[model samples]
Target: MSEFDAIVVGAGPAGSSAAIRMANKKLNVLLVERADPPGSKNVSGGILWGNALAEIIPEWEKDIPLERLITHKGTTFLTKDSSISIDFRSTKFLENHSGYSVLRARMDNALANSARKAGAMVVTGVTVDRVAKEEGKVVGVEQDGEIITSDAVILAEGANPRVAIDSGLRKPIGDQDVAIGVKQIIRLPENTINERFNLKGSEGFAGEYVLSYLEGEAEAGGFLYTNKDTISIGAVISSSKLREDGQTHSYDIMESFVQHPHIAPLLEGGKLEEYSAHLVCEGGIDSVPRIYGDGYLIAGDAAGFSFSNGLMIQGMNYAITSGIAAADTVIEAKERGNFSSDSLASYERKLEDSYVLKDLKNFRNIDKVTWSRVTHRAIPKIAENLLYSMYHETGRPKKHLMQMILESSRDSGMSKSQLILESYRMMRRM
Candidate 1:
């Protein structure tokens, strides 16, 4: 007999959140995960954006096992021997408490427990081989040669989703559609981290980076996040770019980034804690596949709800919102006794009406700026050269800032016109 009223695949932030929402509505939901526990396999440079989590767990910031609340955030450009950063700070940082730095295993497990408390079954180490379809509609999922049936199945499978692809609900994830992220948790004293990052007490820091030292062929960028007693540092490169360049692997990039002259000093006494590698959504809106199909819907990374708009990597918030939306759609579908594609299409409408799709649509052209060869490769070096030249002093006559910019552009093989044009295009589109 079909036991669960609904089945949710992959018990990460998306799946667990969806399960909690549905179970809270008195629907019997089963959340399946392949990891030994809920978040053992998930990885991210993850700083969970707030406000959405409040919908699921109001005052979540007060009680969750949050590593740190972001009080300072910025971007940096890394060179071989030095680095420069642009900082954004305000007295309002303490008031707003923007986001939280999290390790997936810790955060996801906490959320999963909340889901279980809300009356959802969270099963771990269960591999969902495929979503079962009957007469051209999803009915359940197949696990270990057994058919586990349910009225609705929400696929919250992470990036590079296999369940959606197998059921033809979505296409294969292109390498260009995804990026590879490698992160290492470096352990340090809480006080040491605060002093180094110029944060006081428990205030945390988050940052993005454009690495000029990676030799440019990798088409990658970097991010650093401060946690309670550790810092997460890593790089994210285009998946296809990595395959084609054959330049360096994730391991190599992590080592190089930590050992860089500027980064090394900050991490001087830190001990290695944990290392994790994973894939992240790089495709923005264009990569989103069919979100709703017969008796099934997709949310979170599986639906490509994640978006990186150059300046920030945003996923957890989108995942939380989309997961809630997916559950809400199923709630209405059950009320109407309809599980067809037409009914489930409401999920897409719900997301479109919300910030998830709105932001994706709003920043649709971001990849044109972030992933472009000129933007990733030349811009960082140009900024580095210009800053170094403008600041470095010697006996010779110093050049003006304009001259420094021109020289840097020439050194980076970028013309003034091209730079101006690209900057203008980014402004118009982004």
Candidate 2:
């Protein structure tokens, strides 16, 4: 048996951040990972946004091995044959830095090394079977039929939180609350990426799309991110929708997205280098699990901390912020020599007070609206048809723009009254 002040399960951003913070405070910490190495099983669209990361490591840009800084952001709505895109490029995003694209494998390995250097013992290639409890209070963790006692345990076990669910601290995540994300890293020459996306040096672009190519009942969205020499393209679909429709597989939706007319040209000759899949917690603030209990704290995806508005998908920054907040609470508890639920409850309070919970709460309805069949089926088709009708050069005299708009609305199977009501409601909620 071994003992430490704190034992952190999972070596992704959340766990690494927690361990690094605790170790920096001079707490004896143990970071356990199931993979043969840190980040070996991690996959993401790989954008680290916001200043939440700088709180953990102030000099991350100077110390960490980051791939590219994102200076350009684009959002595209893709129809079968065309795409509507909005792009924003600014020198402000380049100066002082706002976000970066990273390879999780390399970044996480570096984070684990940083934690080790901060005096945390990192143990890889080990499976943590369960968390040990004493009188309904978590006291340690059990791994591979052995026990390692600690003052408290921090569970950062990504999307599928087996330990947290089994401990009865959280309900099992429902399929409706989850999304299946499939990603592929394609190898394109650096100059090719620069030419295709109009980038220079280590600056890169990221684009998110609502794809119209998945013509079936599958409601899905796609994303493309530029790295140093590779571009990550992927799609996320609601798992409940997929299962209910009896779809053969999710990859079919991804294939359709890649082959969409507006997307195919960018990937004309790129080689697929790696493929991976993972679950995303898309259920808004309503789905957050119990954050603190007995002698344990939960952070990151394990606690359902992610926000996916129609325009942005943010998870990494939330994970980093929540992880740091949880560590701060634990460090306070250690100071008082108390690991009770009362002592650790501040973690939940702080998280709720932070922008992580505030933004999720504010945009709670956006997730429902974004995934609603109305937006998925009607919005794109209506817009595309309206544009086609207005832009087509017919021999007949052009009708007034208002008359054309009404005709297009009717042609798209939407009444003016219905459009007005829906648009008003969407605007109010969003």
**Number of backbone collisions per candidate:** 0, 0
**Model 1 bad stretches (over 4 Å):** 309-311, 396-398
Consecutive 10-residue window with the lowest summed lDDT within model 2: 405-414
Q: TM-scores of the models, in the given order? A: 0.96, 0.96
What digit string (tens of lDDT, one per residue) describes model 1 on residues 284-385? 898999898888989899999887744468888888899999999998988898888998888988998999999999988888888775666577778778
lDDT by candidate, in order shown: 0.84, 0.85
Give the per-residue lDDT of model 2 (tens digit) for 225-319.
Answer: 99999998999887877887786488988888888878888988999989999998888787898799888999999998988643467888888
Candidate 2 lDDT for residue 62: 73
Model 1 poorest ten-residue lDDT run: 211-220
Q: Model 1: clashing residue pairs?
A: none
TM-score of decoy 2: 0.96
